[model samples]
Target: MMILKLLAPIILFAIAILQGLFAEKINKIKWLKITLICLLLGSLTVGLIIISLDEKNANNFSKQQKDNIDSLRIENAQLKNNLDSLHRALTKGMDDRSLQEIELNKKVSELNIKLEPFVKLALTKYPAYDLQSALNKIAQDIENAKKLAEPPILIPNAQEISRDKTGLNMLLQFKLSKNQSLGQIIFYAEIEDGSTAKIVEFWPSTKGGAFNSGPDSKMIAPDGKSSRLIYSLIGAGNPTFDLKVTKAVTVRITSNYLPEPFITKIE
Candidate 1:
């Protein structure tokens, strides 16, 4: 169709040139003029056919391009809808996590409130027992509950300590100068009967002098074992023991608010 369209105009022009060349002879010959006129009419017919076919083909190409564009737009819309759905899912997950954390904190606070009286009674009545250790156990249980409530992907490793364990497994020895001695000792105590132990008083056995009272110093290990260190200044009228003495120094730790004491030897 396109080739015919291009050739139609050239053919018509050539026919006109031939007619002009035969103009003088046409007065002598009627058949030649008639043949030229017929040729011209045939060229016009061919040109009209070529124009009609070209327009039809052009309309078909335009329709195909429009269909392809519509398909691309539909696919793009579907992709956009999928992306929006994914974003909404992610937002919902975050909101759920936030609510879980809020509930967990509330439960922990309530547990602490309920355990306060028991903890106080244990501390007051059984100074030999470690009430703080029991409290720590309660805190750990709350933490474990919170962990269970969390998503599997966000859960952490267990942090609870064993019941059989007491103070830090590691040893700590301090060398004292003449002016200072063991003062206050804070430690995580584990009792064999499952009773909590507390340090009420510390004293030197030989001199009947009390250790200096102050804030507790705690030492903790990676495995959750811990102990405390206490030191004291020599009191008036109390005999000063030589730090270089080869003999072990005996110290008594009184608990349960009782006059009876437990003894520990330090070398």
Candidate 2:
């Protein structure tokens, strides 16, 4: 069909040329004229069929290209929608994280506000609250108090009382008026084994004279346990005791204006 279509126009032109060249001779034969006319008509019909088929094929190809382009556009639109969805999810997550951070900051601020009063109170009550030295001193005091609470063991015949000796001393200080004077005071000491005695011969200095106990006064010995004693002294210059014990002992001293026992250890 393609060969016929390609040669149709040439055949028509050749027929016309042949007719022209042998016009007088061909015209003289009716059959030859009729044959030439039929050949021309056949060539024209074949050319028209080829042209119609080519137009139909071009239309189909154009439709197929249009369909492919439309499909590509649809796929691109779907991809764009997916990207937009992903972007929206990421944005939402970021927003959520920001909100969480803001909430956390707000909670911290609220907590600080709530603790403001307590912080101020602590600062006022403990001026050196944040100081490491103050903290260490407090810890040491607590440890010492704990040690004082523990009971101690006494060594037999190992206790003695001495004067003008420097050992563990408990100095009692007092604030008094000049008009007021100290009266006769008594010293009492209790040992760890439930034994009690009147502490004598221990003189603590005063403003006017020294507070001295008689030699006949009983001597209270510490038994490496808790012991209590009471005395009366006035006018600033109070007496201190030189404690000597064979073993560790806790001494509780009570004097004038000193209701609470001042506890100490002699090691």
* RMSD of each predicted structure: 19.1, 16.7
Model 1: per-residue Cα lDDT over 36-79, one tens digit each: 77778888899878778778889998999999999999999999
Question: Which segments of candidate 1 are over 4 A away from where they belong?
Answer: 26-35, 111-267
TM-score for each predicted model, relative to the true structure: 0.40, 0.39
1-267 in candidate 2: lDDT tens per residue?
Answer: 679777998999999899889999888999999999899899999899899988998999999999999999999999999999999999999999999999999999999898676566555656866855554555576688876654331112123333343333333334432334445444433334332322222334343245545554334544333333334444434334333433334555554434454454434
RMSD of 2: 16.7
Q: Candidate 2, after superposition: displacement of residue 4 in Å?
A: 6.0
Local distance difference test scores for all models = 0.49, 0.57
